[model samples]
Target chain A: MGTFHDDKGELHGITVVVETTGPRTYIGRCFEETEQGIVLLDVDFHDPAEHDKTKDEYLQHAVKFGQWKKLAKFVVPNDEVAKVQRLAELAP
Target chain B: MPYDPEMVRPMREELSSAGVQELTTIEEVDASFAQSGTQLLVINSVCGCAAGGARPGVLLALKHSVQPDRATTVFAGQDLDAVNAARAKMADFPPSSPCLALFKDGEVVHFVPRHMIEGRDAQSIAFDLVEAFDKHCVAAS
Candidate 1:
């Protein structure tokens, strides 16, 4: 069976935060969606254990000021992702 | 994929030799940023184009009398986890390697992104950082 994902979804070409089941959280530009995973460019990968601030606090900051890009590219596997939300959605 | 560590060793050492702590793991990055006071984090990259200016410039900037409490670096491609963690701390700016950020009490006070370093000479880049140091850093006793 092929992986089913929207090619024309609002997530493409926009800044998003992809939270994984594990400790990792990624914020970046959604480049594309492939069967393997969601391709992100200019990514900022965050491991909650490595940070002093809570994930929600960090997201709140991003919603206000925006996030810096770290990795040139990253691919998050579909099964590994717990939730995917637009960075703007988290804004008030 | 990350670059070959062996290949980037010299590039990494250029900054490390200047008394800048090299953070190669997430834990190390977190620990470095967790401290109180001003900190300087350099997102080192293997791009000779920009890094040529960034590396030497950072070294030169440290010579200024006013300096941050600590200086640290993480290689962009060769140290993915470490670089990512470092960038997370600098979430307010657009991500760019060969970048410099000054944090005062864990808040970003100044940032120099790739575009600012790309065509600039080492002396010019150093001037930019030195100016930021003058504005944001304190002279150590």
Candidate 2:
């Protein structure tokens, strides 16, 4: 995982490159900076066969914008991408 | 708090109409939790699961004979500072919206995490909260 400062000198973006070791991994982006902690902008378990599943998972945990600072991005491995594609095909 | 204000207005209205106070600032959150009594802090969200489960469940549970001394909410996405400030008080718990925290004298005694809210209906969550209220909130005299 790597984060970069923007031209404005703010921590504006992040990138994560991963090697999958198992079925899934958890990823989140913090919404704020605080002594206690930052609230996550999004969280999900990723598996290639289940990419759509990851999307739905983030929707489940999505909070209001008023709750925390929005993070630039969040990424995790999608080990179950095939399963996700299959599910999408089955969806109406 | 979880969604845009336009999106969350109905929810904020529902909770406010039900007597749940909305905390929109850090000062407000601090004042509410600092009070010497049992408090229920709801981390409100816009998720369907939260709408179908947590919010209604909390409303129903509030009808119980025993309930938290103060009932408050912080919008997860919309009220950023307020939510962060509220969670700061919670300490150590990962940030989760559509979550519930039960506090006594400014200390967290019980936490109902997000995973507990998903895949459950409103009634089930209400039953859980009513049970918690009966156990921890009833005796707060």
Please report the candidate that would top lDDT against the real structure: 1
Candidate 2 regions exceeding 4 Å error are A1-92, B1-3, B139-141
TM-score of each: 0.62, 0.64
Pairs that collide, model 1: A69-B95
Which RMSD does model 2 reach against the true structure? Answer: 12.2
- Encode model 1's per-residue lDDT on A19-89: one tens digit a residue: 99998899886778778889898887777788888888887766555566678899999999888877756
In candidate 2, what are the lDDT values of residues B1-141, reduced to their tens digit? 245578678867777789999999999998898799889888888755567778898999999889989999988888999999999987766676678888888988877766566546789888978888887886545
Model 1 per-residue lDDT tens digits across residues B68-94: 999999988888999899989977576
Q: For each candidate, what is the lDDT?
A: 0.80, 0.63
Number of clashing residue pairs, candidate 2: 34
lDDT (Cα, 0-100) at A82 in candidate 1:
89
lDDT per residue as tens, model 2, A1-92: 11222342221111111223555543343233234332233443445576665644533333211112233343322432222111111122
DockQ-based class of model 2: incorrect
